[model samples]
Target: MLDKTGDAEALGFDALADLLNINRVDREKARREGWRTLADLVAVHDLENSSERRGDEWGAGSPLYQACHVALIEFIRTAPAGALPDPFAPGEIFGPKLPPTLTVV
Candidate 1:
């Protein structure tokens, strides 16, 4: 739930990663342990956001945040009623992919 006040832009990638609790270690652990549902992941995100809240740290207007929110909403909306998708599964959301690299030949 990032604020729309352009605050997220002020946050560096590390800061955003910390705020989201999706750092490498944590993400790996979570993936290994498995998240039961997208809702659960959203709850964790909201919980982290709340625990880390520092009085106007961010608001609900940040386009970045909105994009994330929308992504979650879309996931939830498209998910089957009783079948939650494995976001970490092959070709699934959040699946592992190498970062784009530029080669200077």
Candidate 2:
């Protein structure tokens, strides 16, 4: 099911492929390029203009292409940027560091 603007939808691999209107080959290519989720696809939008994909198709001035681009932009803009913990942050993951000395019993 799709929500308003057709942005909010649980998009698995198949659904994402459908939304992108890409075929099996392209999908596989995208997967190979580390495009696992819809957000990943949006993040890799540079490929649309870059010489990454097999064919320079996305950059073409097509209605579907424009729509897809706009949809992704809007979706990403509206969606919440999920908060992820920083691995390097002190005490969060490593916890409090104890003294460097080790006492033998």
Candidate 3:
């Protein structure tokens, strides 16, 4: 689950597990093994059944996979081209300011 934060954080593999319909065991095991990014999880699972992970494996078909693919791509495409400001530099320290559409239980 994404924390309520305005600062765009790198979307991790665990976050996309539901969308990918990845099993819980695989997700938890991946997390324990320090698989942070989608590419990392793919590498561990051999999603393509090949020696190396390929981006094309997730292309087209499978609505859930498509959603993840689009979301990840859009995230990278729209990312700012500069380093982010240090959140702890000085002054006010506020909690995350996420999108209003998101609701955390």
Candidate 4:
């Protein structure tokens, strides 16, 4: 069965109450935050942190660094021989172009 945060929270509270030998609320509070699972919460949290981490270089202990290292390893393992692009090759030209609606004064 798929695990939900609400289910875990309910189980945890129930266990805690049982261990403490005390009465607790019978109903669980409605979660309006939309995250239903631990994975969902983690994904949202990672996305929130990603923006903050973008400007900084990945440190050795950073999750981003670990993820990038794993990705690079997987890419190297699966990539076909000689499929990599040449870094010295001339790339497409990119520059600001005048808009068609503008006329020279």
lDDT of each: 0.52, 0.54, 0.50, 0.40
Local distance difference test, candidate 2? 0.54
lDDT of 3 by residue, 1-105 (tens): 133552113444645555455666666776688755544544335322223233555464344345556776787778786544545544425545554576789
Give all TM-scores, in the order shown: 0.26, 0.34, 0.32, 0.25
- The order by descending TM-score is 2, 3, 1, 4
lDDT value, residue 67 of candidate 4: 58
- Candidate order by lDDT, highest to lowest? 2, 1, 3, 4
Q: After superposition, how far is residue 23 of candidate 2 from its true place, in Å?
A: 0.9
lDDT of 4 by residue, 13-56 (tens): 44533432322221122133443342332222222122233444
Q: For model 2, give the RMSD to the true fold.
A: 9.1
Predictions: Cα RMSD each: 14.7, 9.1, 14.8, 12.2
Off by over 4 Å in 2: 1-9, 37-61, 67-105
**Number of the predicted model whose TM-score against the real structure is largest:** 2
Worst 10 residues of 3 by lDDT: 44-53
lDDT digits (tens) for residues 6-91 of candidate 2: 45245666676666565666667876886655444543443233233444565443344456678767777787656445545555
Q: Identify the candidate with maximal lDDT.
A: 2
Question: What is the TM-score of candidate 2?
Answer: 0.34
